[model samples]
Target chain A: MKSKTLVIAVREYLAAVKTKGFLVGLILMPLLMGGGVLVQSFTKGLEDPTPRTIAVLDRTPGETLWAALDTAAVKQNSGTQVLSVPKPRYTLKHIETPTDAAGLDKTRLDLSDRVRRGEVTAVVEIGPNALKPRPTTTPGTEPSEDTAEDSVYFSTNRPALLEVRDFVSRTIQTPVLAARLGQSRETIEAVSKSSRDVLASRGLARKTDTGVSFEPRSNEAATLLLPVAMVVVMLMVVLVGASPLTTNIIEEKQLRIAEVLVGSVTPFTLMLGKLLGGVATSLTLGAIYLGGAAVAARQLEVLDMLSVGLVIWFIVFTIVASMMYGALFVVAGAAATNVKEAQALMTPMMLVVVMPMFLIGPLMNEPHGTIGLAGTFFPLTAPLVTMMRLTTPPPISWWQPVAALLSSGLMTVALVWLAGRVFRAGFLLVGRPAKFRELIGWILKG
Target chain B: MDDAIAIEGVRKVFGDFVAVENLSLRVPAGKLCGFIGPNGSGKTTTLRLIMRIYAPDAGTVRVLGDSRHGPADDRVGYLPEERMLYKSMRVGEVLTYLSRLKGYKPNRIEIDQWLERLALPGVARRRVQTLSKGQTQKIQLIAVLIAKPKLVLLDEPFSGLDPVNSNVMRDAILELKNNGTTVLFSTHDMASAEELCDRIVMIYKGNKVMDGTINEIRAGHNTDTLRVRLANLASNFDNLPGVACAIAEGDHHELQLTPTADAQAILRELQQRGPVELFEIARPSLHDLFVRTVHEGAA
Candidate 1:
């Protein structure tokens, strides 16, 4: 036969999971987190896509100009390729103009008409001496003048015009340099690769028994955001999981169900069942988020950098924290007559639960800081703050986590004991919620 | 085990307020006992002590052979004054869940049968919040009795029920008694107690005022009042011999005679004066005795 506590736990779990709020929270929380990650990744390396059409009057007197335009398009498209963003393909229109100064000026004057007619997003004019080196310049010497030589640009869209100007500049410069150096493409690539110095940056890794494993360092701060965010998520689950206990207890009291329940089971049994149910709820939510995070981490190829031990600690800490907070809420609920009174009684406990969220930054920055140690050793904040510290770069002593876990467990048990006493005393009470003095009186009398 | 419950000098106090004081009562096994008292008269406090919802500060209480406090027995079932079950849970689910907490297996068939018996078969899958007041009361009553407990304690069970629903609840209590379950319900409604209780216990200001069978309590009170109905006559019947006072009661007149007065003489004189349609000496009712006893105890 199952114990009565298990029955109550199962009933409480079923009651909560059957609600529409549960289903919505279960599905939407992960989707929201995934959406955040996707938004960051998409916005990282690419600018917003705006359509552009370029009219290039390349007066450089050769059919090879088409080849230069193709190369520049490929180079411009390659900028977005590394980030996996879709390239905003631009239409390249070649303008037929005489190589004389008068004809060039006439074409430049017509650029605004073409833009007004919507024939192109922008017009770029190239002079006949656009790629011709001046007699004062030699190979390997810095070109004092730009190759596009006083090119007149016209556009209605500013962003599109900037992109077109960049494409046109690169289209003229690469070919002019190659012609001036008289070098083949293979030789230029080889020389550039040999002379380039790539400076790679990495974050300091936690020193394990074996060796240090460094995490890839990027200018993006999101790499450090994941662990701290996990702490916040776990804290959020703890708070969410424990909220129902207060309302449920006070509701049962106001509805008089607690009278019937107390007649059939011990107050301790009822409290134990409720605490177990809360832990189960928190764990269920944690599992959904953890699974979603795992899928996301794997997709982002950061799965290897994630610590399995930290996740395990997250599960343990969430259960302990939820039980501790759930017990306190139950006690507060039993002391009150209604939801409003219950919330009033729970104000102090709510503050305690919120303390760790504020300390997240300090703990993430210095896992062994004084604030981190205080949070880890203090029974109220230990489970959350300690779990956060374990995921940060600075590795804590093994004894710290073990000590935090043991202390949190003891504190949870003590709180449950106190809750049972409060419940027995106030389950049948009505009219007004107990004052702090009365609650203390109950505990001391017990 | 002749008595399902036995309390002796049970005293409970909240802060400085004595909710129940030196209150002792007993309910015979397989008997329906009405715990009668007016509002705020220690009725709820005493019932809670019986169910172990509140531990007595100064005495002993034994229910179903258990003396330990705090819901230590599975043989006791309680229906509190407030009838709030899980409002969102299905009717069957709530019943089954409550029964399981009482250490019984979930019985769908039994639950469905109960729903049908209560004329609520269609509500088996409905939420309790959607039910009418009477319907919710019936379901809560069922939850109390579903565990087949030996001792059932109901507080203010008939407070807000209509005549029809009140009859249903009255019959349900009697049915539990027939099943050999000890049923003790607290109520301020005296008529129901007079009609339904085999034994009644009355308390006032946390003090026991009366306890015994309803007939025994009524017989103990002075029964000198006479109820008479007659045709039109002189309105000076108040001046009749041996009649101390006459008060009109609906279609009849209740004449309270002095202790030294002769009731036979008064009836004869009234008959000689006018045509008397009805006249009878009335016994003291539970309501009358309750009012008299509580007043006397207060004095």
Candidate 2:
């Protein structure tokens, strides 16, 4: 009996695992993820070198202001501007020679006309008189009585408008504050120099707080892992999707082969081989996917999602899911006489699986929340939680996942026992579902 | 030696109807037994019970000694009436596969030998779906015999066979009997049953009506008959003096010689009427007796 079951299992595995589809899934999955990463990095690198050229329209002077703003960070972003229109280096091209308010009105009309026609990006009017300083109103902080006033006019251009705002708040105010405090420009220059070194560290810390980061490297990695894990969990979910009991009943009735096979082999062995075969197929595909991702990450410098912890949990949870579903499906399939009944009976199982798909966002959100903990520990939801936690890193005590794995494993064993009982009777039943009372009696009678 | 098949008081009830009730019979080893009955007369139900296709409600069936082993035992040879052969499989492959399922890997060379013995019309590579009805019948015969079990059970093996294929099957069943293989087959064709069966069990409405050798059954019924032909007529010859009872409307008289009188005396006295062209005396065959016995039993 043992040998027969092993032979059947091996045949099933070989039939599915050696197919070109399996091989393609193994090889293509990683290559695709890795390619995505490489492409993103390539685009990021390209954008890095496409220097940002900012237009200067300060009325004071170019050399002095340029020097003040030419610290390490701003210099890194400056580039040559195209020579389409002849304009001042740091002042407005159409400033009026106004001795009165009428002259200012003419100047305003001329600038407005050019702006509406989209001639220039934006106009910055800066001559100390136009600077308007708003005091910081943070609670418990006294407002500075002596403040520098400057006005910078903004245009309708989106980036240009934003740039003009940034120049006033970031560059002009800092310089003005230091001057009012009787500090030299050299002291302010040192403080700006130190801030650039800490930018990348801040970016890294921000992402660590959120495992599913949108930073080029981690987001692309998370994106790849999300689908891979989703596919794994989905395939495992098929165990629940199509119950073994349902098929067992239908097939036994169809060929009467059940009458023959059951003579020698016990029911447990039969259910075990079938469920294990499905799990084995899933594991094989999972391994292939992970291998592909690993190889691509190495060769193409892409993000790898099949971390040691992820692979372990994925295997553990998928096996549990396969066993549990195999047990449940066998009962369902065995209960059904026809395919239509089987499908109808399976709708609830579908709802059970799809409910988790909706909960996947939460699993992604809180890998160790009430939902995540429920998903991880609950036999029905754990298979997906195991993978979702990889994409959306969950926060909880480390033992939470361990406890989930152990608990679901125990539940799956119970399911295996239940499935075996269903298989023994249901596998050969060709007629209608055993009445609920009968089914329950069968469960207890044994 | 124990009978190859022995069912003692086997009773099967489906809801209210008894499919086979108190059925007790035996087919000794090496004898060809035909299970005969009308449709729904429990011949198939009895055969299925013997094959363990269905368990008897009350009684025991001993096949090759032990009854516990299922029809899947491979020691039993069975060809169901419905004729299930995998259509996608090649004829030879299916033949070999069925043989293998019965625990024998009948070599293609030997399979071809059997096919040739049955005189199969198509090549070995032909798919089963492509074969004509007669040809498929031959394949089924070979599939059962390829394993060559001690007891072979066939249900309506002659249902669709043409004259030629029918003869071919007849020869094959005879050959199995010659080789000491006990065969059990169910059929409605009384002529074939008379020709092939060494003994038969007749069932009706899930109950045993009669079971014995053809000779024993015929003698038991006693519907003895005689056939004669005459060139000229003895007017009212059907009511003639020497012929106590004559059944002839035209020129011939079919007279039943009385038990106390000799048939030769009647034939000589019939010469005055006309020169008789032909004379014969023999008991009725099993078919004649089956109807006579069943009708008489019913009355």
Candidate 3:
């Protein structure tokens, strides 16, 4: 026969998982996560294969800007060599037109129809003084700057069209400024490259028996995205699992059912059972979210960015984190008289579980810095902060994670002991709800 | 025979308030004992102390020969006053879980038998929240008794129950006693206590005021009061000899006799003055004794 604690744990597990809410969470979690990847890929593939034919009506030195736009497009396409297919190519067409307002209006009307019919993606009209610098003093007047009047007109409301417009403006503006400088094209290019200061970003290099060797810098997006995802999943599981534990205990207390239960089983056994149930709840939700994330990463071809070591750490951290938070939830639940009372009592605990969220960005930026190490040592934030550090380029020392795991495990045991004392006294308490001081007194007395 | 439950000098205090003060009561093995008291009379507190839900300030409680302080023994069963089960769980599941907690492996056949016995045969698969209030109470009762424990402590089992359900519970308690299970129940419902209890223990102001068989306690009061209901009686009913005082009741008169007066002698004199419809020597009831005992203790 199973021990009473295991029986209670199994009962709590089955009771929660069989509910309709669990079923909804089970189905919706994966769909919501998987849909994000599918939508991004779908939009990327939807770009029209036929090169978008853009009509350019230039008044002064339009040929130079058109050449620059093609060059930028080639550079961007070449960077897509990692993918199986090439990016959408742009073809710029020069159209002849008078530089007067009426001529511009007529040309626009002619091109707008082609754009509407999908024959052209956009029309760019360069102003009459496009390549000339504005007069510093407007012919015997106060000095003022002149803004460029270049315009891009497109018919479609698609997002890719917006991207194309941005590319065209950037391509033209670079050369226009170069023309204004009155320098040769080669001199202008050399000056533009050397004038701007760009910071070099590199991963940490550690000393080894073979001398210094640098680890490759992690992908910036993956480094931030993975930890943020893990933090979010942790927060969600804690909230979902812990709140129900509080409500369940309060229900038993208010209804006086706990009095009957404790008569059959010890308060410690009952509390341990509840903590185990909480672990099961959190693990179920963790599996769905983590599994969805893994599938999404594979679909996006970024699975390699997530290592086997990081996955192992994530699993260990989730279990330890769940136990710590789960015990607190049970303690709060046992100490409360009602649902409202339970929520009010759990505020401090909830804050502890979510404090790591605010530190996620800093931890990702400096995975081995003081802030990260501090959070890793704080028992409440250790699991998530350490997991975040593991996802970074630099590997954390083995002792840090091992110590964090042990700390969390010890904390969980202490909380279970604390909750058991509270349950013994508070479960049968009548009249007003006991305050935090009284609960502390119970713990001390126990 | 070993007493099923024995509490000695059990005292419990919460904060500055004394909930149970030097209270001790016992139930002999295989007897249906009623714990009688008004609200806040420490009945529930004393039961909690016995079940080890709360440690007594200065006392010892033994149940089924185990007195060590800890969780309740598996041989004991307790039915708390308020009824509660997991609202989302099926009736059978709740029963199974509770029985398993008491170290019993309750199979489907056993669960169905208890369900049928409680007249809740078709509700084994129904969620507890869906059941009526009376049905829910019955389910809770089954959870308490499913272990077939040696000692059963039920607190206010019949409170809020309708007549039919109350009878069902009353019968079940009697059946449990017949099966050699020692039963201790606390309630303010006097008539149920009078009807079902083989022995009655009454507490007041956190102390044991009266404890004995119902007849023994009643006989101990020895009020020597007689109740006579007359269809046709003389106007001077108060003038009868040996009647110290005459208190008029509805179509009857309660007479307190002198210490040396005989009840039969009063009946003989009353027969000459009026037609005697009914005549009985009054025995004090548990309710009457409880009120007088609490009031006397207060004074």
Best by DockQ: 3
Question: How well does candidate 2 reproduce the true complex, by DockQ?
Answer: 0.08
Q: Judged by lDDT relative to the true structure, which candidate is superior, 1 or 3? A: 1
Query: Model 2 over residues A1-446: C-alpha lDDT tens digits?
Result: 45545644553455456556556655555456456878887554232222222333444433233345445224433432324322212222434334455865576566656656666545444444332335556898886553222444544444634443564357665665555445667876777688766745211223465574444454544553564455444454344223444554475456544533342245565566666666677677666555655675556544444467666766776677667666677777766677887787678876765566777666555555787667767767666665575455433466766776777678778877877776665665666766777677667853
Model 2, CA-based lDDT: 0.64
lDDT of 3 by residue, B203-246 (tens): 88798988999889988997767888887755456677788998
Sorted into a CAPRI-style docking class, model 2 comes out as incorrect
Estimated TM-score for each candidate: 0.76, 0.60, 0.78
iRMS of each prediction? 1.6, 5.5, 1.1
**Ten-residue region with minimum lDDT total, candidate 2 chain A:** A85-94
Which CAPRI category fits model 1?
Answer: medium
Pitting candidate 1 against candidate 2, the one with the higher lDDT is 1
How should the candidates be ordered by TM-score, best one leading? 3, 1, 2
Error in Å for residue B230 of model 1: 2.1
Q: Write the per-residue lDDT of candidate 3 for residues A15-125, one digit (tens) a residue.
A: 778777667766665566456887898777555556766777766554666667667777756654345655566777777866677987787788888787878888776
